[model samples]
Target: MALAQYARLGVISRSAPGLVLARPLLAAVPRSTTTSVLRSLASSARAGRFASSRREPGMVPVGRRTRELPVNTIIKFVPQQEAWVVERMGKFDRILEPGLAFLVPVLDQVKYVQSLKEVAIEIPTQSAITQDNVTLELDGVLYYRVVDPYKASYGVENAEFSVAQLAQTTMRAEIGQMTLDRTLAERNQLNINIVESINTAAHDWGIRCLRYEIRDIHPPENVVQAMHSQVSAERSKRAQILESEGARQAAINVAEGHKQATILASEAVKTERINEALGAAEAILAHARATAQGIEKVAASISDSPNGHDAVSLTVAEKYVDAFGNLAKQGTTVIVPTDVNNVGSMVAQALAVYKNIGQARETPTALPKDSRKQAILDTLVPQQDTPPARK
Candidate 1:
């Protein structure tokens, strides 16, 4: 029975050969009391074995480990980008850097571990009110790093949480200072302001705020709709203005073109009229020149030929008869001279007029004006015979 009890308490295994128990002590205890004690011890041993088995590998129970490091380890290897704050006898001592480090067992303990590398913290979506009284939901990301391990470990209970809260408050404050339009438009500047504000407060916590970026901003649905409408209306207004300007320019151009065309047409007409007048003048001058040349030739012929005068007299007689015939044919009534049949007399009158004109031409200043006129008239008029008593 004692041997079984010992095996049940795990002091010895039943399968082990040659296992022994103290008979005197087992005998001295009362049988009932001995069974109860063995049962309690067996239960405790089972519990301890089960708990030890359940614990994670390489992990010490809480309060038994120094800052997650294995207890009683003299040599520790610190990872890169990490800082381990050490405490010696419950007081601040020194920090352990990356790589291999030694610690006096039982005397030195790692109190806190800080990450030297940058960390990203999410700023949860929170309501913010703009200067224009518009409410917005804003969320962002914050990038930071631990600069001083000692301060990060001692200055603040939780560096990341504190920085995150500061960032949110600062973002809200900045948004409150700006109008809705500015908040939406100048997101980058808003982020920068938030980073600056966070760094200022987080300096004691040994955290440097590198940058802040707004992930999203959501305005009310009505505001979004209104903004859309405003943009559409503005675009329409610009389109109308551009169209009107284009139309006005087109009209101006058309008017200018018409004016130019009219001017050009008028100029062309003026040129045509001038050309026609010049042609007519030239024609009239040419005719006058031809007439003067013919007259000179005729004068030369009359002076050079001895029969010229007779030929002229005969030509004048033929023309005078032809003139009378033409006048009779032109109309039923004709004005005839009393001596119309006397062709010889008309020829004599014409020759006399021709002679006077020849003499005037020979000496243009020889005859006075009155004498030349009277001479031509006397030659043209025939002498009248005495008329019978007025019929």
Candidate 2:
């Protein structure tokens, strides 16, 4: 009986152990390939975790290795300058092709924008006195360009602002030392000199001085007014001088005309006087010739009167009578040539000559009664003897 109970208890124990063993075998039989696949999956998951832990943020993962990637690895390079920012999210989306990319960290980021293309500066207008003690104003412009990008970026805190300030200070110092007159007189040359001076120093600051211009200058109002007045006065003086000179020339012309007229009048008078004198002389010569001719003819005809007393008396009486007759015809006043005392003597002489001629012509008369005595006396007398009878 003891042995049977023991066998029975042993069988129960065996049955429980067999149940445990059968349940495990049944589960193992259904999941054999699945278990192998699960094992491979777990191993793959472990490897992926390991890869993820080893990768850098901006690195491109390439199977167990990481590469410092270019900006174009996942996005197009939108060209960023140093110290500038760029948003490339959409660009990266277009470039990435189910792949990986790397990029420089933010601390090493490059800039992407440029600076201003041009810069201008104005120098302060300066007041100065010229060598002539004249006050003047000087104003100028400064032009500059960035030569070194790196120096422009790092040399000055603000390149434009710093260069402008430097230029102002430098120009002020230079202009103040110059006289106002010099600044005004040599504006262009001063600009070039200033530009050269500024450029010489600006080269170290990565600035290049380009062309410079002088804008405007203002002088004292009085100086300008004085210059204008001086010009006007000069013009007025010149006009006055010209007018005076013209008047003088006119006076000279008048004098010359008067002189010519006087000379012509004097010459005319001289010619007239000479002609009158010549005419008088010719008349005197012709009258003398006629008188001589009359004298010669009278002398030739008086042959019987050689002593010439009767001829002279006759000629004188004839001339006197002709003069009286001519004076009566022309009604001219006359001064007779014969004296009253000589007139009777001249007439008696003429009568005596006539009687002598008559007596000579008479013949001895025949007796005439007159008685016969009177006839004889009458015959003895000349035929021209009328005066003896009257006595």
Candidate 3:
């Protein structure tokens, strides 16, 4: 039994040269305990030798190999706004939501870990040509979130990178369709268009494009200078138009003022002429009335008084003399009456003329109209002598 135990323990085996020296130590030990211990060690050595003989190239020994457990391999605690995609036996299986989740050790693997939180991605600056042949450098930021973990994991590889590239392409296409002026003026609209386009193409990617914002736009230096010059020219044109309008309005006002002044002046002159004519007419009427009144008074006195005719004749004689005196003082040219010294004869002639006029007025209807005018003329002016008639 002792020999058999020693043989089983490898102490007596010539194949184990190193164990040959432990035979005495094995003899001192209890047979049963030593046999059990030695049997286990011998079996372990046989296993090691067999494994080494069949080991693949570069394979580490079992004792020296490291055993590390991957995260979420068995039990996992998911955080808020996070999702884990699990594949069973390398196939689609289920998703792990937030909170505690247990997974089959080797059968289930968390293939993709996606965060449900919003993410901001920056787009690198790139050159794009507008419809107006203007080249511009544009950069922007994109906001996105994963809505479905299954699609986010399997629908598209590298979701963030793909979405960012899609954003850049969409922006370029949108900018290309518009002119430089429109692109600059419609930045918000441009961003909306880009987001819409990206969302359309990435629908199956399980990513929601929340918004896109243009951070900066850089145009060529010459284009910027040209825009500045255009703005200046437009402002100057507007100013010129306003100035011309003002000048034209001022000229019109001045012409209107002059026209009004001229019309007022004409109206004043007309009014003045009308007033003067009215005054002249009134003066003539007043003089005629005073003369007629004086003549009527003189006729009434001549008819009422007994010595009226004689007094009138005497006054006429004196007036005739005063008229001659005034004519002599005025100038040297004077025609002396034939009977200038015969005052009594002149008075008699004046009285005779007054009596004739009184008779004509008393019986105006008795004489024909022609005879009456002839009689008055015959009395006032002397008749020429008749000449002999020639055969």
The best candidate by TM-score is: 1
For model 1 the TM-score comes to: 0.59
How well does each candidate superpose onto the true structure, as a TM-score?
Answer: 0.59, 0.34, 0.59
Clashing pairs for model 1 are none
lDDT of 3 at 124: 96
Listed per model in order, the count of residue pairs whose N, CA or C atoms clash below 3 Å is: 0, 10, 0
lDDT for each residue of candidate 3 in 117-232, tens digit (9 for 90 to 100): 88888999999999999999999999998988889889987788899999999999999999999999999999999999999998999999999999999999999999999999
Q: By summed lDDT, which 10 consecutive residues of candidate 2 come out lowest?
A: 12-21
> Which residue pairs in candidate 3 have backbone atoms (N, alpha carbon, C) closer than 3 angstroms, thus clashing?
none
Question: CA lDDT of 163 in candidate 3?
Answer: 95
- lDDT tens digits by residue: candidate 1, 89-203: 7799999999999876446767777777778878999999999999999999999889999998899976777888898889989999999999989998998888888888888
Predicted candidate 3: what Cα RMSD to the true structure?
A: 15.6
Mind giving the per-residue lDDT tens digits that candidate 2 earns over 181-267?
467567777777767877777676666788677787777999888868988999999999999999999999999999999999999
